[model samples]
Target: MKRRRVPALLLDAAAIVAALLDAWVHVDPDDRAAAACALLAAISLTLRRRLPLLTYVLALPAAFVTDAVFATLAALYTLSSLTRRRSLLVVCAAAFVTGDTASWSWPGPEFADLTDSGNLITVTYSLATAAAPVFLGQLVQARRELTVRIAEISKARESERQLLSDSAQAQERARLAREMHDVISHQVSLIAVRAGALQIGNRDPETKEAAATIRRLGVQTLDELRHMVGVLRASGSDPVELTPQPSLTDLPRLVDSSGIEVELHTDLPADLPAAVQRAVYRTVQEALTNVRKHAPGATATIGVHHTGGTLRTTVTNTARTRPALVLPGAHYGLIGLRQRAELLGGTLSAAATPDGGFSLRLELPVQDPG
Candidate 1:
């Protein structure tokens, strides 16, 4: 639950009304000096938020000249709530006590009557009255500070929990990498070696070509596996890359190797940031991969162009010419691509065209070269 805050204007208005009421009870308008001091004190409450000390000083004259003490007490409370200077508060409280107890005479207040027993009781009561607002103000200040400290503690605990969760995830990834390296890699290696042997032994042109393609793809898979293993082995504390990440320069090779009819066109600047280039490349790669999985025997077009400070990339594919194979997929590729684009201060959008085609568009802001 949250607390509703009072409007400053309303609070100031209330303080002014309270001060004027106190004046009505204790001050006589016939005495111009007392009336003027009380009115000045009432008006000074508006400045309490910005200049608490000044407001307190301005309001003190009313406590000395007349019995109207509401404005002076309000100013004191405001000052105590905002400032941390204990000694200054003590002095101001003492000044308020003295002003409330002394008698107004000639040029200044007379304290001769304070020596009497009755006057001493009056002084003690004045001291108690002054301490009331100070204690209340200090309590409010402490509560405000405690709220801020609690918020900071909550944020710290949340960060700690996230770090622990990430550590557990990293451990799982490492275990999976070990399994792939020790088992899957061995099987793939055997396949590649046998494929190579068949390509060499067979004289038939079609068989040799198929064996060669298998060997090539197996070797590429092995390279990617090695990279993935390295990434898994390295934790967040120490980042290590076994192979360079793909970027715009690799887009052409990626399109060619995708095994789909893709027409690539790019008109990007040569000096784009590496992060921006990688984001564009990944967005295109994921779009093309989705096309391959969902739209079999489809022709695709990829267009990447830079205009002003914006980089735009679009991937579109025609409707499938053949039925899509029932392949197992988590369907997280586009979600991951959209998150990546957002991380780079960019956007990713995908939709089905009116012609029964799929289209993906990515737009990113580029940093100025100069």
Candidate 2:
């Protein structure tokens, strides 16, 4: 309301100026008191925003006495938009009736029978004068309220979408952690056990030393990998699925379900270790998720290369082709992937493309010591 004061003041000033001009140009010299009364009515406009009904009550009598239509209109509009008290409306009506009769009292007959043509015209004019501005102001107020409600609805919907996105990401991360724990950790422990047995049984010094080194490296890696996976497992998520987790081979299914146009190329070995395969699948999954969430209708391209001693995975998407619903993100997708890649002795990179889309790249060692 305080912020509204300045604009309201300007509008009231304009109304008062118009009333002053009408009085100065048209009123007779002997009727200068009428002009004075109109100026007084204009001065009362300061209460319009804070005390709109009071402003109206003050304005109507001064308007009747001074012939200041502008002051009356401004007061009526302010009252209609700012308040809706039936008692106040009744008071204003009483004021109007008294003023209307007082104006005609000098030149016309008293209100007797009250059905004469002159009285009828006076009544109709007064009713029209009271109703028009108030009705218009009420219409404007209703439309403004409607607009505010629509904006609130839009903001509320966006917040709900953000919450859903965060929940889904957390669930996916937890699932990944469960898979690494149940599958990769178990396999690595078996390798360590086998190495320990070899070190104990082997007779050759060279063979025994190699087996000892393998056992030590395997144990160290299992410790680090387990720590990272444990952090994910600690998250609140749905119960783990017993079915085998997704891998690189599930890329087609992910793409088909995404509803975004995608092109893919790969030169990966079919027998990639479960950990590497899972990492590659997640990298692609995250990239696609981002595209659908932020760049709807954008085309995507995914590439995998297993060359030399490393496997490199890349997913890139074009800029959004059309307007789409964008939900707020937790911003942890790429950070989590980067940490996972580092744990696997690899690297992850993501950057915006020239077309305003984004690209994610991850490179993992083809083989790890443990």
Candidate 3:
């Protein structure tokens, strides 16, 4: 599978071959005995990845009786790499010592000094040689595990960065939506009301000139709205057009264009935060727009009062004698205006007044003098 596993496979194949050849040529006289030992060792090597302890058990007998050194080394490597049990390793070491002792004691060709206890030196040499394969396998296994852990950590960090990017984009989208709703809805409502008044008063030339000016203003507002929409759609690729934003100062112009005489009363402070001013402006604009659409030819009055570190605005309009044609209502503009107010820690309410009219009220906190 992996390139690293190829070397382990080659090593296992070589070990099996060496054990079979040694048994056949030097240790076992019978052909069947050597073949059986070779087959068992090969099978144990293959199963070592899944059952390391079992491989050690199968290789111990051949290692002790016939000096199958390759079989012993392969089993030891598999056991050390695949198993985490320390008790099992101690048991395997005991089995190896006992098997090698039994094989050395057996009467055979006395090539070395047997009486002088020099055989123990051979046994120690064989044990150390067998340990080499086990150490190599353990090192390889540890490196592979460390590589895998580092890769997982990198992936997790990448996922967190992507999530933060998505959250920032979503926040920007919501801000753009709120701005578009506040700007376009107020301007369009004023245009509609002024156009209706100009159509009704056809006898006066001055009224016609004023209506023409209102029409030009409406067109300019629409163009600005389109540019804002384009910038929002393109994201950072297009720069936002820095047109003048309507603050609380523009409230008088909004009332003038509504085609209804609005009696204004005020007690607002000299200066306020930019966000508070914009929020108050939009709240009044939305309320007056509702008044013009729902109640035609009615006298509307706006009241602004600053008290207890809060600015409060109220817009009330009387019902007309003749019922006006109600405009097609999408209802999202009011909800968005309310959300804008709440975002600035303010409150807004709209309801039918007791005096046969509609009333809209908004209250926003004002910063105290530094």
Candidate 4:
């Protein structure tokens, strides 16, 4: 029901001029009748946008009486703009032609040549006037449809961009979680082993004091682990944040906490990259955790060697005096260890030894020290 004010005004002006021209060109001298028809046609033009069908119906009778070409064209324009039904348009056109013919025949007796070549000219002019409005209306409809299609395309593209961004964010979050698992699991295993040993060993005063110290250290390590997890959880828009992550240099303290006598043999170069060091450290930690869980009372040996551009680590533990405890089958620690090694373009393997023991091996690319 949107009213087109500009088209209405133009139609009104055209109607008025048509009415004046009809009256002036005719042989009959009826100025008052001509002026009345012109005024009525102008008023009818204002209602065209709102009630196009009614305007066309009203215009036929008025045009027949006044022979106002502009009023008929204005009504035709309204029909085209408001309705898309072709049959209705054809019906309206036929009615207009019939009305024009009837109006020409009305002043027949006095002017025999009134419906002659001059009448044909009027018919042609009236059809052209009517058709002009219909063409403009079709052009407007086409423009509107094009605008709608473009808007739909723009919205689809925006949705696709947002989907890609969300997918990338999810991938990054998973990678960070894997790294955190590798770091925390290794640290927690050492604390568990040391705490278990301190509860079972010798009762001399100095020995008791050292055991209590180990127990306290185990408790402190657990607290720090909890704090680290909390910091990771409160990352977004929060003041508390996780400190820089540990890499490989912290491995000595981790190994000491296991309370296992470890013999280290190394030919690894000092210039190894931080990433390679971290992977090697994690592999050793997982191997030692397995030893503490599955091979109690066992002695462990850790060896690091470099040949060509590759650095290798191997951890081996002998059988225990007490029956070996079967560790709970959790893949998170091992899976995380393997992922860390692979991230640095390395490989890792674990195997049972022939003498009721276990061994873990890891190999990584090395940087040579001068």
Q: What C-alpha lDDT values do all the predictions have?
A: 0.90, 0.77, 0.73, 0.70
Between 1 and 4, whose lDDT is larger? 1
Highest-scoring model, TM-score: 1
Q: Deviation in angstroms for 208 in model 1?
A: 3.9
- Model 2: clashing residue pairs? none
205 in model 1: Cα distance from truth in Å?
5.7
After TM-score superposition, the amount by which residue 126's alpha carbon in candidate 2 deviates from its true location, in angstroms, is: 2.0
lDDT of 2: 0.77
Over 1-370, each residue of candidate 1 has an lDDT whose tens digit, in order, gives: 1233467777889999999999999999899999999999999998999999999999999998899999999999999999999999999999998888877788876883766999889999999999999999999999999999999999999999999999998999889899989999999999999999999999999789778877987899899889888888776757766567777999988887677889999987788888898888888888887888899989999999988788999999999999998898998988998998899888999999988899999989886567
Q: Which tens-of-lDDT digit does each residue in 1-370 have in candidate 4?
A: 2378677566567765665565456414565665565556556666777887887776666565665556766678668766888788877876666666553444452222445888777667666655577777666666777788889989989988987886676566555655655776567657767755765676676566557657766666666666665554443435553534455566676677676767877665566786787677768778888777777788899988888778989999998767767666766887788888888888888888999888888888876666
Give the Å error, residue 92, model 1.
Answer: 1.1
Instruction: Using lDDT as the measure, name the better of candidate 1 and candidate 2.
Output: 1
Order of quality (TM-score) = 1, 2, 3, 4
TM-score of each: 0.62, 0.56, 0.51, 0.48
Which parts of model 4 have CA positions greater than 4 angstroms off?
1-202, 205-210, 213-217, 237-244, 326-329
Residue 249 shift from truth in candidate 3, angstroms: 1.5
Model 3 off-target regions past 4 Å? 1-203, 206-210, 237-243
Query: lDDT per residue, candidate 3, 24-103, as tens digits?
Result: 66565665664566557656777777877788778776665566556766787778877666567666765666565553
Worst 10 residues of 2 by lDDT: 104-113
Strongest candidate by lDDT: 1
